[model samples]
Target: MLSYGVSKSSSRVPHIVTFCCNNPHHPTTTHAESHSVVTRRALSLLATATASVFSVPVLVSSSSVRYLEAAAAASTPRFSELPESGGVKALDLRVGDGDYPVNGDQVAIHYYGRLAAKQGWRFDSTYDHKDETGEPIPFIFILGSGKVIAGIETAVRSMKVGGIRRVIIPPSQGYQNMDQEPVPPNFFDRQRLFTTIFNPTRLANGEGSTLGIIIFDIELVSLKHL
Candidate 1:
């Protein structure tokens, strides 16, 4: 028979081991083999625990990275270029629920006009009436009648009542070249819109040199047949 007793050693860190055997006739493990077995078991347990601890953090990090990528994709603003060569690039912010307006149909709208900028300052709005028209007074106009610029007219033609759109009007659809002679009665009364919606400040401040592209946030309020 063989057995081990608990005993204290001089070292502060103590390693304890206990073993017992009922029959001495059968061969038993040597101290080196016993220690080897214990060491292997401890190493296996440590490997399992380390893998378990580190695996959670790696999985969590991967999941967080995927979540952030999805969020960024969803939150990014969408801007589309027009398929046609000459048309304006219209971006629908909110699609309207009612029907679109036709040519000569009287349309009521509220709009905010601004120079396209990262921090675009509002040049004019129906909400504030920069040109002497009463604020919030809906601008009533006949569609497709040369009553407005080509970009605005094209945008409203596709909009339903209550829809909001942002249209980028190129110089061809906006103020003509300043160096060139004044155009004939073509696009509607630029003077009237100037007095109502557009702020002449850009021209006054000499910021309207080429007057390249203008941006309008327009909402269709109502439509009436002529």
Candidate 2:
């Protein structure tokens, strides 16, 4: 049997959209708004603390949002691959042999999430959390139903009951506009939701930034369907 029930390789992503308001300076609204034509990010946690929230805490360091823009006319691309087109990347860390899930299936999992950077910290983990009975709290969600991030849904569908995979969720697929960058017209509602859930203190402390990429380490615990 797979504890709860069921289930990377190194990958780097270049910085995408640059923002003006995501900085430390409380710049004049007039100046900031002028530059806000295209920039933004946020996390989409659940309604309550106990709810199966998907995601990580974040970090920020550069107080130079605008400065960096000035420093490099578009920072040099970090890696050779233009990963944006991939939408989400799921690198198999461990393959499992249990039943794989199909769409509409209810799934359970244990996950550890963090920023996609080398210095990123493990912000949230089911293994680290236990109920009064000392049992780890596994997250239950319906597969391919937008219950979690798009990347997570895609990754879980490919896994068996006991597999482990490292999933990469771009700002577009993860928290939409947590970084407050330019996204699609349709995603505005999701962006607003995450903005409300994101912790300002964490951002201020350089723990995570708005609209940043998310790195998730997922283990498939079990599946109820398919």
Candidate 3:
């Protein structure tokens, strides 16, 4: 009868030991010697398996690091370009529900106006328009009536109610030739500075003639068909 038992070796390694009172073996080996050889072989296999198990985590750890680095690079925002529409580039920050406004519709909006030439100098914002009670006042106008700048009107016409959009207006589609009402608080002062730098020679030469290039973050609050 052969029985198997677990025993610890001098090296403190655990392995399976076979015990046999009388067992067939090589002519040079006794039953006890065969048991010892079997135990050593078992220990070697277990040690190799233990090493293999620990090595897996090292490979997974390196792979996980690479995955995290790729995720971080993908998360970085890029603003080198934007979609253009009829020479006026527009980017929708939030898409709204409901029907789109059309010509003759009474539309209400809020906006933050900035000058591109002044490194995005904020000139005005509807958020600043407040009543005596401190409630916000939205700017209202009739669509397609030329009540606002052409670029803003064009951008709004393409938006749905409650949508928010950011537009970049070139000088041709901006405040050129228009002393738009509800002007900036420092419009006159800005005009004085603008006049000093206004160059007709550059204007005719197709250079930087007009400093009217502006940016606007506009949100269409609501609209009513008139």
Candidate 4:
């Protein structure tokens, strides 16, 4: 399984075993042959330590090895594609407890919005918007209010408080056809951007019609029942 660790600089990084097998007792033939005698000795020591932890003898079978690999794969993040929503996909970076928000519930979130067309160009980020005391200002809206884009609202509907998700939104569910209120705290710039996207001439030429895929890294900070 993946182990996330924070460094002194507060950067998150994964620490994983040297091999996917992760069985010190039975090293893969390829790796075993390449390693020096000293490395083999180290693996032997690790096997001894592992045995001490579990009194039962560890049997390495093909089925057991496959199970271990599958378990490790499950620990990694994978996108769950939503059907009938124009190919919208969401990957939960952090899953939270509690019930998901329903209609009319007020939800607040901090998000990093990027555009797939422009090489993941970050269009906006709530983290960049800070209060006077220096706290990031979350964007809040009532669920199903239609104030925000469809993709964002759809993803938030399934998120619980403290859950973080990365959503991929196709143009159809984004700013292609409908008009949405400008997102704060850069309302003016966002308004201008949306206005351009909604322009008749631009839409006709397919210039801004395909708003391109939008990538949102959204954190459901909190929710309140209406």
Candidate 5:
């Protein structure tokens, strides 16, 4: 006869131990059999051990990780190679030969000035409350008579009447080493001060005040006979 014994610990926390003995009558028996009660006890003990070991803790995933990755990828920089004037990209022009004109020519224009970073306007003739609806005022200036900044005069000399153009004036040709009202002296040292001059004209010995970055949308209103 063959005998199998199984030992177990407590019921709430159970452990099992199995022992087997060979039968004298079955000398060549490679397998052994156990009673139903013992087999069931062994299985119960195994189930208890598995439950204790597998009931620990685990981590789960959320959308935060995916959102962060997407944000980083979107922040990548992009570059372009194109011509730029007065810090403004020129897609087209309306009037003028794209050159500066001489003095004593009647001119009309509309303009606006603001910081390069799109901050609020530093100065704008159109926004003056004195004019109803704040319309653009027309003005005239003589070229190269110390009436306007060197940059503006230079740009005007290249323009013709009834022409519109964009001018990019560096600080060197603009205020240059001087400071004026509204434009503080500190700004003169900042090399990035530029202007866009639209249409402009040369007045007849009409000396104009020197101003920085005068972008004129000039129409040759009329010219004085030489």
Candidate 6:
């Protein structure tokens, strides 16, 4: 019976040792290893996803910037070109030619601004006129100070007092790169995307817009030479 008891104790001791070897600390170490591996993989995947998302907009913006640069280069010649008009006979007034001084000068005139394609008056001081049958509107401007647009300054200088002339101003000369108020968003965007920004007056409100021409029927009221 003593030998049998000793054998039983030896067998029990082996089992206890095996149980200690497989205890919580060993399992906890395995779990920690597994958790670390999973966390690393998840972080890698999140970084990849973030990079993929940001790359698309970056590519799009880059392409847009390139396209705009190319378009601006191509449209360079349009500015120096002469303007054409129908229905309203255009008067020959070349920019930077004749008495139209580029300096600051006070000028008074009757004028109207209209969209050439739409054939509608966009702005006119003619509304105050009690008589509407082919009458001129009254306006005053200080040239080069930006009381008016570049094209208007050019046109006003070409005309003598009481000379009725239809002057066509291309986008390059008029509001080049400047956004005029009351224009549609789509129109403004199209203009801005393609047009060169030019503010002869250097006003803060000047922004680029569509490639339309401005027709000015001008009568020079006065010129204050600077």
The best candidate in terms of lDDT: 4
Candidate 2 on 1-226: residue-level lDDT in tens? 1233211112222243344566766444554443333222111111112222223222132343343333233322222222443467776666888999999888998887665543554456677657899888787788867646666776777789889887767655666434432121235534444543354765676645433577777899999975
Candidate 6: C-alpha RMSD after superposition: 29.7
Write model 4 residue lDDT over 139-198, tens digit each, in one string. 889989987888998888888888888999887788754357325446665755566556
Candidate 5, 125-172: lDDT as tens digits: 322323465543444555445655554455445545555444544434
| lDDT (Cα, tens digit) per residue for candidate 6, span 91-190 | 5332222354346666666554565534543444342343466554355566656545666666555455545556666666655433432222345543
TM values, all candidates: 0.54, 0.48, 0.58, 0.60, 0.35, 0.37
Across 167-215, the per-residue lDDT of candidate 1 in tens digits comes to 8877677644332211222234334334322346765766553344677
Clashing residue pairs in candidate 1 (N, C-alpha, C atoms within 3 angstroms): none
Q: Which ten residues in a row have the lowest lDDT in candidate 1?
A: 50-59
- Compared with the true structure, the alpha-carbon lDDT of candidate 3 equals 0.63
Whichever of 1 and 3 has more TM-score, that candidate is: 3
Clashes of 3: 0
Decoy 1 TM-score against native? 0.54
lDDT for 12 in candidate 2 is 22
Per-model CA lDDT versus the true structure? 0.58, 0.56, 0.63, 0.67, 0.36, 0.43
lDDT of 5: 0.36
**Poorest lDDT segment (10 consecutive residues) of candidate 3:** 50-59
| Candidate topping TM-score | 4
lDDT of 3 by residue, 1-226 (tens): 1112343431243323355546556233344654455445443443443121221112123344354344434543332223354468877777789679999999998888777766777677778778999967888889888757788888888888878888887766776553643355466745643552355665566656346677888889999998
Best-to-worst ranking by TM-score: 4, 3, 1, 2, 6, 5
Question: Number of clashes in every candidate structure?
Answer: 0, 31, 0, 0, 28, 7
